[model samples]
Target: MEERPGRFLGVDPGAVRVGLALSDDDARVALPFDTVKREKNDKAAARQVRSVLEAAEVPCAALAGVVVGLPLRLDGSEGEAARRVRRFAEALELTLGVPLHFVDERLSTVAVERTLRTLNVPRAEQRRVVDQAAAALLLQAFLDARGQETWPEADSDEAVAEGPSPGDEPAPAGPRGRERRAGARPRRKRR
Candidate 1:
């Protein structure tokens, strides 16, 4: 097979099972891969995930990174589930010795279920594959955001105070880190 740049693994950690998805060799599209039984502890789960990835035989060098779903609350606050996922992701990154990224996964599963229902997938089959689909959604979102070119760097207080020099257009959102981006920057008041 012709090798491309690299592949990225997407993970969705649930209470009982962990879903997995993999990006195409070009790292553009996400395909649902498999699901693994979760361990009670974060480190153990990480190890289990490592083994699963190794079984795929995609060398470490071939992995561009790992994208994990972070199930943040509707109000944008992290709950226990989010915290647990973070812990698991951290351990997995350390074990795999690869880059790890977390994407806001609020309602990701719900969206996947909706899509599956629209596709007329059986409820039983949906249960078997929803997690993997959610993983693909998370990875796809990350890939989409990373592909944007018009994103600007984070603006400091002075930058925001400058307020675009009277006529400058508001910059398109970046990779969601700055105070003005779509997800990372926390806003005090609801818009």
Candidate 2:
């Protein structure tokens, strides 16, 4: 654990489950955190997510912001799903008091599924971890994009005006090279 300057929470909001990921303090790596089982009430789901965030034990002040996966259609249009994600993001912002940033997550779940299959994860087991895996993928994209100078400041007008730039090319469909297992043990911190 080298001293990370900051961290960001990543969200993959779904109708039944909300996936969560946390970036390294340096914002270089994204790790699966947990999944929030949603109730019929959106507010209740938001509360569940907030509780998880609090229970992670990291200081809220160390978080840079929240990055939410926006599930846009292939044509880059916001469908009903995208609208729901936006609503969820708004509610989460209200609950957590953190700025929200959206990242295009067109095939995040598919990518996660592919990685699981490659790792020989059983179909039944995949269902349990898919959401969190997708969240890690989504957050990894945001973290990688940030390295490339794509992410704007959380409070900047350009962030509002331009939205999250996915850059000119789409992210790879699946995790590159090695597969990251769900709930993998955290790496030991170096002295």
Candidate 3:
């Protein structure tokens, strides 16, 4: 098999399972690889990921880096879940000796669930597939961020300063007289 440059492995770590995604040789696109359940112990998940890296023949010299999703609250506060993610990262770093990149994953799972549902994944089977889907989504976001040439980085102060930009016009009313963004659930205002 031909080897590629910058072979990146993206991970979505969970309490019980870890989802894996792999980028193309050039590290441009990320595709879902596998979801490993926590077997006899959580060590199984780590082993499974290690196996994928080994079987892919991704040379250590060319293994560019790893991307890990960092769990955070909607308000950007770190919590217990975030702590677990940190610990997992620490362990992986020790084992892989490769650099680890963190991507904000505040709502990645929710986004992945909606995506899977739209793809007609059965409810009974979603749990089995959610983590891997999340990994793919996270990696895709990371790739898109890097692919945008000449895009200015928005300052944190301005990123959330307003509701929507000029181009973000509200979606047209639907046939049932409901106004909802395409593929998004209707929003409810808090009292």
Candidate 4:
């Protein structure tokens, strides 16, 4: 369990289960990490996620920030599901004391399902892993665009360089502004 620095956590928020992924130290590759079972409590779910982040396996890695999948509709409009995800993201951000960035996850699940079919993954197993796979896809999309000039420039206030150390006070309130990225639209904060 080697600790890698500068890793980013990616999340796919769901009502029943939350999928997670982690980026490499360089932020070039994304890998499926784990799935957290949600007990209908946002705070509890966020705690579970924080546990994963604080795992011994990645002890030295500083959490750069968090990337959440915003499940927008095909027409580019946010529906109830997207709103739910945003709320979850906000809660998780507060819990982890990290900045949050959102990526449009229009067909991340569909793409993961297609890949699972191509790989001949068993249906039962696919059900268990699809969310993790979708999370990885969403994270990869963000990593891929991060180095491109066309990517939307995130506000300086919204970009986190490092997370709080253990036993330290939780980070201050995050930036209210949205992160602008290429091909991905920013999620508006609900009133």
Cα lDDT, all candidates: 0.86, 0.82, 0.78, 0.81
Candidate 2 lDDT at 25 equals 76
Tens digit per residue, CA lDDT, model 4, 15-119: 888999989888889999888787577777887888876774753237777889998998999999998888888888888877788999888888899999999
Distance from true location, Cα of 85 in model 1, Å: 1.0
- TM-scores for the candidates: 0.74, 0.73, 0.68, 0.72
Overall local distance difference test of candidate 4: 0.81
Ten-residue segment with the worst summed lDDT in candidate 3? 38-47
Instruction: Give the poorly placed runs of model 2, Cα more than 4 Å off.
Output: 1-5, 150-191
Consecutive 10-residue window with the lowest summed lDDT within model 1: 153-162
Per-residue lDDT of model 2, residues 1-191, tens digit only: 23235798899988888888999878889999888887666677777887887787876667878899999999999999998888878888887777788999999999899989999999998988899888899999888877877566767876665533666444334334544445565456689
| lDDT against true structure, model 1 | 0.86
- Output the lDDT of residue 92, model 2: 81
Q: Which candidate would rank higher by lDDT, 1 or 2?
A: 1
Candidate 4 has which clashing residue pairs, if any?
A: 152-182
What digit string (tens of lDDT, one per residue) describes model 3 on residues 104-188? Answer: 9988989989988999999977888888889988988887886674254576443445576778878878657878677886566
lDDT pick, better of 2 and 4:
2
In the range 26-111, model 1's lDDT, one tens digit per residue, is: 78899999899989988999888888878988666678889999999999999998988888888988888778889999999999
Q: After superposition, how far is residue 191 of candidate 3 from its true place, in Å?
A: 43
Q: How many pairs of residues in model 3 come into backbone collision?
A: 0
TM-score winner: 1
